[model samples]
Target chain A: MTLEEVRHLLDAEVLSGHEYMKKEVSKAFSCDLMSDALTSVEDRTLLLTGLVNPHTVRTAEMLDISGVVFVRGKVPDEDTIKLAKENGIVIMITKYTLYVSSGILYSNGLEGASILHN
Target chain B: MITIKLKYQVEKDDFMKAGQASSNLKKVLKQLGINSKIVRKIAIATYEAEMNIIIHSEGGSIDASIDPEKVKIIVRDRGPGIKDIELAMKAGYSTASQKVRELGFGAGMGLPNIKRCCDEFAIRSSFGEYTELSITIYHSGNNTEEGGE
Candidate 1:
């Protein structure tokens, strides 16, 4: 789905990269562990994470992730948001917990970015 | 042959700057028109190595060299080194502190992940002294093979 659709479906606030909402993301990976995310996430996937830190954005940049959704009403600090913007990654804030957000996205046809190993 | 060499210093416990070297290397690779897949692999491997220095070591330097045939990243640090290389090579073994783990890393996957992403990987260290990693990924035009010794 397009990021625009994701934003609307989750009732999220656009925290950065507002101009790139038209970008389409096929898979979503929800995890707070940056190591697991690094091991699993594919290019252009959406990262749904509760970890609000610069490292989160750094992980997205390293993996070429399309965007990040901050679950559980979590919002990144200024440095984190700035880093996301610099990396051209779209960021959104949502009130839903990680699990609920994943469920909503899954029901809407957004699939998980499956890991080959844990 | 003209090769590009870049050096970056990673500070101890500077989580915010952990991935800068890798990110910069990724940008350079992309600008050089390296294959996206190859670029991604290099980025992942380099980032993992960089994170290791930030989380586990006192400090380190990453030296990256890019040529037409391949890219090589060497990360060296002076710190308390791995005592058991074999066990540390396992997929889920980490000695990162609680603060590092809270950042979503230190899950014992960093080294394994780096090894998986490179065409060649080698590590050497003396306990309580230092650790060093050498990772290389070859560019084979279109069909790139993945493996390392």
Candidate 2:
């Protein structure tokens, strides 16, 4: 789904990269642990996370994630928002908890990124 | 035969600046026209190594060299080194403090994640003294598969 659709599905407010809403993201990965996110090999996916920090943006930058959705009504600080903007990562905020948010997106046809098998 | 070398000093306990070196490296790799897949791998490896220094070391430096064929990153730190290389290499072993864990890291996947993102990975350390990590990723643009431990 395109980021614009994601924003609508979650009732999310765009915090950064407002210009890139037309970008399409097919997969989604939801995790609070940055390490777990790093280990997953998924590109152009959307990251649904509860962790609000600069490193979240860094992780998105490294993995080439298309966008980030901060769930549970978490609002990132200015520095975090600025970093996301600098990295060209679109950021959005929603009131739905992480679990519910993931479910909503999944039910809307967003697939999960395949995990690397051991 | 262009070789670009970049260096950055990582400050201990400085979570705010933890990923700067890796971020810079990623930008440079993109500008150099390396494959996006290869660039992401290099970025993840370098960022993991860089965070290891910032979270565990007294201080350190990250040195990255981009050549036509491969990208190499060397992260060296002066601090408490790993006591068990084998144990530390495990996917879920970590010595990071609670404060570090609060930052959404320290899940013990750092080293393993770095290894997974690189073509070659090596580490050396002296307990309570220093640690060094070397990660290399080829630029052939076809080796982006997730590595098996």
Q: Pick the DockQ winner.
A: 2
Q: What is the C-alpha lDDT of each candidate?
A: 0.88, 0.88
Give candidate 1's error at residue B5 in angstroms.
Answer: 0.9
Candidate 2 interface RMSD, angstroms, 1 decimal: 3.2
Model 1 achieves a DockQ score of 0.54
Residue pairs with colliding backbones in model 2 are none
Per residue, candidate 1 scores C-alpha lDDT tens digits across A1-118 of 9999999999999999999899988889999999999887465689999999999998888888878999999879999999988888999999999999999999999999976463
Off by over 4 Å in 2: B141-149
iRMS of each prediction in angstroms? 3.8, 3.2
The second chain of candidate 1 has a TM-score of 0.92
Q: Report lDDT (Cα) of residue B94, candidate 1.
A: 82
lDDT of each residue in B41-125, candidate 1, tens digit only: 8998889989899888999999999887899899999899999999999988888889889988998988888888888999999
TM-score of each predicted structure versus truth: 0.95, 0.95
Name the 10 consecutive residues with the lowest summed lDDT in model 2 chain B.
B140-149
Give the lDDT of residue A35 in candidate 2: 83
